[model samples]
Target: MPTKSGSQRKRTALLLLLALTGCALRVPVRQLRLPDKLPPEELGALRAIYLVLRLADAETASPDKLSRAVALAAEIRRALEGPSSRVVAYQITASDEPADYFIEQSSATGVLWLNLPATEPDPPPQEVDASTATASARPVEASLKAPYHFYAEPGHRLILKDSVSAAHKSTSTAENQRALARLLAANLAKDLAVHPMTLHRVVEEGGEPELKEAYQAAKEQRWPAAVTLWKKVSTALSDDWTPLYNLGVAQEKEGRFDLAQEYYAMALERENSKSRPRKSTLRRLRNILATLNRLAPSSLEPAKGGAAHIPAWLRQKMAVLPMSNETVDIEAPQVVRAKLHQALASRGYRVLPLQEVDEKLKEIGLTDGGQLKAYSTQEIAKALDAELLFYSRLMDFRVIPLGIYYERVVQAHFTLTAAASRTLHGTRSTAQGAADTGDVVLDWEEKVQYQSVSEPKKWAEALAWQILERQVSKILKVQLKEETEILVLKCVNKLPAYFNP
Candidate 1:
């Protein structure tokens, strides 16, 4: 007896009830219907791998072979870039050293010809038949699989997952096929953290105590003591990069970029450095480099990875969090709700007053970075009725970095969250900018720039925030290598019903 409209209304009500009751169905949507192939942009990201290659022998490759070797290197360089992006190349060869990589063969028409004794030698005949009217020669070919030496960055492993027709997952291609194979094999061996050459250098190393004591000295702001302790530690630690890193920081604090750069180089010799400077380190380093670059700008172009990318849309919708002053706490829900309301609206996004979200956040305090784990997405969404919500975590872990800036490495973790009811997008960036590295006198140059932990770090912190703001805004365009698996699990667990696994 019910009308069709009445039945439709009842069905809609039932679906809404199911969604509200945590019984919403999950769509099997991963492995989304991707185009049969990857776009050029994605592949472009992985090209031009920095390889450390070594040749089989140099004396033999000289002149005729050397000419071929030089020619082969040129060919590989040309092939790394396509009709698109320019290949930024860097070659560091020690004087008179053997070539790092070489081609075993060169293309001749459709076939490959090995750089053999360009003229073949006559092999002696083993047997002769007096009765035979004629004798035939046996066919011989080059050893195609020539052994090449590879010494690449450590802790990275290359798996020879099935080869693709078009150099799938390769940093570059060799003019000759064998050189390409060597690169693949070397990547597969990327897992070895210690090179045989390096292991030979740390003879009977035993000095963790010295390093620990040096760390203590730096923590106490006793720069002189820390420098001396690090010197002893380095001797005991087998010329470890820690001292060099500490020394670099000390030099930076002293505003000695020229000298500090030397220590940075020494630190990098440790290999496969995650120790690579973060944006903060580079910003500080860049400011120094730009100043130093004017004196003698070396060929090494500054790496651009530290720069931030922000989209225009995001630029209009930023939040300005109230700076933490000991008197006011950010732990209250009203504070967070109010800031969100004011900031989002000021940034040009349509939003209601903070009073609207207060009731919802009151049940669970939504203020402060540490307390973010306490909120549920449904609760957050229910509170603001926002299709997407943005959260900023303002932290003041002072006393720590201030202590380490004189001697050791200081680690800082920062995150910005951009969330939808169910779908979430965010970035969790870490900065491990060490202030010093090596055996040195910290106060030897306090009057100079780049030295000591002082009021200047306020400028450093400001730069960090500036970079972070840009990084957060780039989410829509640049696919930053952000791994969500490393995200704060507490918030991950509370994602909205729609994004539930």
Candidate 2:
């Protein structure tokens, strides 16, 4: 008979194989849905509204003034009817089909109010028969008119809360009134829109032909083709979240969980906070997170959804990437990286050596100096066995000419990302320093001070050559180094607050 330990080992191997097979067979399906419950401010995009232009008859105003105001109101009505407006339809006439919401504004003062018309008004009570009336019958309450015009008819609810500013500083009264009329009309059109919760479906419907093709490929489970199209879409709509979300879905379906999770996290970052996440998005996020937590607990540990302070352990194995160079010279990034490395290493931080980092990257099949843009910081950190990643970009570098002195200025942006949770913390630093130009004229006075020699001109010439031959280069380097050091220090000082919590 086999020993107990041998039997246990065999059973464990079998279970592992079964789990791997299950993961391989699983097909993820995500459903995208729009939210139904929306805040009032965002509900304006889904309703039909119209404007009521009430010109306050002022006896002091001339007939021409009234005509001009009417013309301006017509102009505003046209402006409000553009294709971009969410309003179903708008008109200056009250004879149109009853609008769900009405925006009434005074052409004189530019005051505005939104009104909801009563579907049915209570009919006035018929005069009671004197013989049937009891002595204690409720005395008829005399109706008194409201102090200010209610704007809407009886029983209609009017909200007189919105006050708009349409003031113009024109010398001519007519011009000012025209400008106010335009401004008031635009404001009223925007205010009467609905304020209800809403949801949207993430449909891969229309765009470029290539995008549609990509969507079709994804539906057929052809992942690589889908990924290509989605990536193109992402580049085209760099500021939009749709492509990023779609890419995440594709990666998840293909079993590239790590990449999928990163893409989803990025999609969330790109998403607008005002818009609620689709049901499909929320479901997919939860599925990915749960799967990652089960398969690789370490990778899921840093999903803090916020900028949590950097932990002490993460600071042990840190990597600083080459800063992005925005200037003409390509060597600036490397130079700055080397200086920043020295600065960090000197501060007792065990900064990863550039050679060792490159070797690790090669092991992961990334050759050359592939910075964060080429690959994600999380991917690079995992390859280098780094818990913390430092990224810096040189935003500006310029030398301002000042006659005898050149002012060197450097501005840099820095970000620290935690590899485990994908939290980002960033800061910007700037430094300015001056270097003296080695122009011959700059030292003309010093040369004149010692002018008593047989070969005074020759001596002066020799002296100037000795002092100024490489003086400009030397001065620039010193000044630049000083500026770089100051910038680095500022970044370092800010790190504690950003990472510490």
Give lDDT tens digits, candidate 2, residues 131-241.
977433222222111111112222233434434334444434445556655765555444432112222223343467777787777667686887888888888876666
lDDT of 1 by residue, 1-501 (tens): 855698899999998887764432111111111112223222222222332222334322223333343444444334332322111222222122321111101000010112222222233233445689566433322123222222211222222122211112222222333443344333322221111111001111125777666666665667688778766766666545667667666665555556866766655554224555455544443443343333312222222121131212232222222222222222322333343355345434444445444444555665443344455433455555543334433222111233224311111122222222111123222211111111110000000012245356375675555455434634442211121111221112111101000
For each candidate, the alpha-carbon lDDT, in order, equals: 0.33, 0.45
List where candidate 2 sits over 4 angstroms from the true fold: 1-315, 362-371, 402-405, 422-479, 497-501
Off by over 4 Å in 1: 1-344, 364-370, 397-501
Question: Looking at candidate 1, what is the lDDT of residue 338?
Answer: 46
Error of 1 at 28 (Å): 63
Q: Give all TM-scores, in the order shown.
A: 0.18, 0.27
TM-score of 2: 0.27
